[model samples]
Target: MTVTASDAHSAVQTLTQSSDTLFLLLGAIMVFLMHAGFAFLEVGTVRNKNQVNALVKILADFGVSAVAYFFIGYWVAYDVTFFADANTLSQGNGYELVKFFFLVTFAAAIPAIVSGGIAERARFYPIMLATFLTVALIYPLFEGMIWNGNFGLQAWFEAKYGAGFHDFAGSVVVHGVGGWIALIAVLFLGMRNGRVKAGKHTNFAPSNIPFLALGAWILSVGWFGFNVMSAQAVNGISGLVAMNSLMAMVGGILAALVAGKNDPGFIHNGPLAGLVAVCAGSDLMHPLGALFTGLVAGAMFVFVFTYLQNKTQIDDVLGVWPLHGLCGAWGGIAAGIFGSEALWGLGGVSLTVQVMGTLLGIVVAVAGAFIVYGALRLTIGLRLSEEEEYRGADLTVHRISSTSND
Candidate 1:
């Protein structure tokens, strides 16, 4: 018949819990749509004969990551206490809901990146297995540290150096993971066939530039949710975070337009580059600083991808390394440079911490990716059989599956 004051407070907390759940769901939807953007971009970059396979592979990766990670992968990463000062809903099984929502889309992205590199090749099963491993094990380690602090790299840095690294969203965690994985995938799979056959069109042009344009635009749009909403606890920096994201995009696009010789292709990549570049600083950078950071990142991808393709043998499929990996690194560094000491009383973050974060991220991401892919190549093998690679994955994987129907 009587209610205690504790009951009143608990009821209010319960209501707040519902509100957080709704917001988290919204962010999840926005992030999931980014996967669609990746799909369209992959389709635009790959050969037409492989179109069905591209969409199918992406769908499969999303489905696989969702189910596998939810069941066990989330527990492994968040359970270990990757960060010390960072938030971890609880140990063992407490953080499942939050970790699940954040990681599903990230896991989905790895396959999309792989789709570009191993396009027109790679048997369905091998790619699926590889995708599951990367998302299930590789990615969770990175995410676990950043969010849960169980491993406590950030804590160690803060404890030893009195400064800490920050990733406003996940320039390193999400994009860097994908980029590094993409690099390894291509290395193992080798270049696409006819990519360098003498006298052939080695420089495979995008089949649908318009699609690239639209997808790039969508990626840029989706990034707002990726960054602004990432301040999950709401320490009062969301507005500035959103505005900085917008500014960076604008700056990135303009710089790309100026430097890309009026190529819309350059422009599309520019916004993407800008988004990648500003990710670390989305919560910290001043508007002008964000713009500059974006500009630099945009310019790098415009030239870097072209130069790499011309100079090296790595056909990154859709420039994932340059756009996400390289750009993401710059974004992280930009945060320290742009971050003021005043926001959230978090104080001015040091450039040393930012740069260290960037460097550490690059080494770990690239090496970790290479190791997983190499082991797979050595063990089960990462590439498809020569005949399967030539014939296309859709035909190889599906023709057999559909034989009963016909």
Candidate 2:
């Protein structure tokens, strides 16, 4: 059999497509595992009585997010839908389907972040409703604006500031937005019962330090895939992203160790703070710049979390606002500063554009949280009853406890 030039070209194209498809599928699987990290993180932090609820919420939220994003969020963000026949959808080795899977994991993270803040007090079904609304509508709106360039916001930034906002991996888009929205839900839910007693915060130590550490470890391991695979194609992968992520993680660990006075919770969360900050600039930063970004984020999380717990009535359990919200914002700004040739980074990021884009993400997050959580609060209420709260969500919501012995 003689092979023609056209046949040869077609064969190469097919090979390339298949490779890219496999790469993206592996990345999506890695990200899916992060949901277990979320579950265990919440489970370890909340009281023992609420542990089961924490586990249940993360899995349920992911399920809900999958449905919402598949049906609505993907269309909103990319103007693509899965309504086509299987054969049509399976084109390109089903790369588009895996891309959606990878992205939906990110979408699901918003509700998981909120779950930590409002744990032990929030009703289950109402939280699910908020999860559906956020994934299907609110989150995808900003996601489209920044990632898909759907709303012309990126173009406006480029025209005005010399460069568009450059969040290579969504420091502001995913972590920042999720963190700020979690803040709104925390506020609406108020402090957990007996969290504060006459202006002094009560000590609610983690239920299981080992579980907390395990969760942190899982998230840290999976984050490599999260940042490195954002490129989404075999040709676009970079070892620089992996290196920067590593330096930032260490920087965060060391900084949190020093600043947090050797507290285990702070130590565990330090790497996450660094990872969140570095996501925006991992592809463009010098390792030193990434290290500094992580250092700042790690220290900032300790200080801000301590202040919010001690000085304010904001009962942000697990400190999502500090870890994700504020650090995520700093990451957006840091990308502009660090991702410049003058600063030993790859150039093409603008400080003005980064600031503007970060603020826009925060605004969208805050507004969306208010609209979703506020409506839930006013209509069906957002919290468990006083009796239910004392009993814990496990018994009240799930009809079980973390331990059978109880």
Candidate 3:
């Protein structure tokens, strides 16, 4: 055994590629599990009569999203397609495939977010169509502009503001877009039956606190992969991202506890708000800055959720707008503020650019949702019939329930 230098170099290259592939694959798996978190979160929040529908909606949407993203969405966003043969696709240890798997999970989150807002009163098939269209077209448009730098948007931001829009892990691209779109769907569908009767807001409390807590826990755990793995390669991983995520999670929890006054639902969703807010700046912020960002997000969720339900009567179950939409917007803006050298941050961002990008994201998301959902409302329809809603989606659509009548 003679060991050659060439052989050793070849071995190192293989190891590096393998490591990157495995890292992304694991990240994909972790994010994939977040769908279960979405399902359980919705299941626990909606009435038991709609539990099965919640579970079914998340899974079905994920499946449809995969198809849409694989066949069309990925191309629109990145000009990359998976149309080649398997052998050709297997190059680079199939890293591109795993990358698609990972990012598609993010894309699918649009429908998952909407499912919560329109729970208990949506038609399954119509929503599936919406999911397909959203993933294939609507979501990818923003994703491409933000993530892929499509149309020179990022370059334009940098030229105007001395820094490009910086969303490290898709605070605006994924969560914000999903939340705002969900808001449109909720508005278009109107409040659930009996949610507000005779101008009196009725309480539609969560059905299962334990399940809600479990869902939150899963999302919190999986978010590390969601954030850290955005690096998408082993060589780029950062301990800072992980630490920031932890600090933000705790900040959210404590703030929610204080703002929500120990309410179980708010307590559970608090960490999620924190995590959502931290995703954009996790790589660039100090742990303390991350903590502040999380605290703001938690308080925002509790207060805004209450306001929307009581005053606006939006009937957004699980408050996805506050938890994802508003907090995600905050994350995008806070990234530029907290990521500055003056704040002991990494110092490559501009606050002005952040605000512009965030506002643009809001406009794109809200407008896209309005167009798609409005068309659905006008044509194929969006909401269930009043009688069917009273019967519950599980019974009327799925013909099953969380509990056995027998």
lDDT, candidate 1, 20-136, per-residue tens: 655666677788888777777777666655666777888888998876677656776666323343445443223336546765776677667667667777767777887777777
lDDT of each: 0.74, 0.92, 0.92
Cα lDDT tens digits for candidate 2, 150-173: 879888878888888899888999
- Show where candidate 1 strays beyond 4 Å: 1-11, 80-99, 199-201, 234-237, 341-346, 385-390, 399-406
lDDT of 2: 0.92
Identify the superior model by lDDT, candidate 1 or candidate 3.
3
What's the TM-score of each model vs. the native?
A: 0.87, 0.99, 0.98
Off by over 4 Å in 2: none
Q: After superposition, how far is residue 283 of candidate 3 from its true place, in Å?
A: 0.4
User: Distance from true position, residue 171, model 2, in Å?
Assistant: 0.5
**Full candidate order by lDDT, most accurate first:** 2, 3, 1
Off by over 4 Å in 3: none
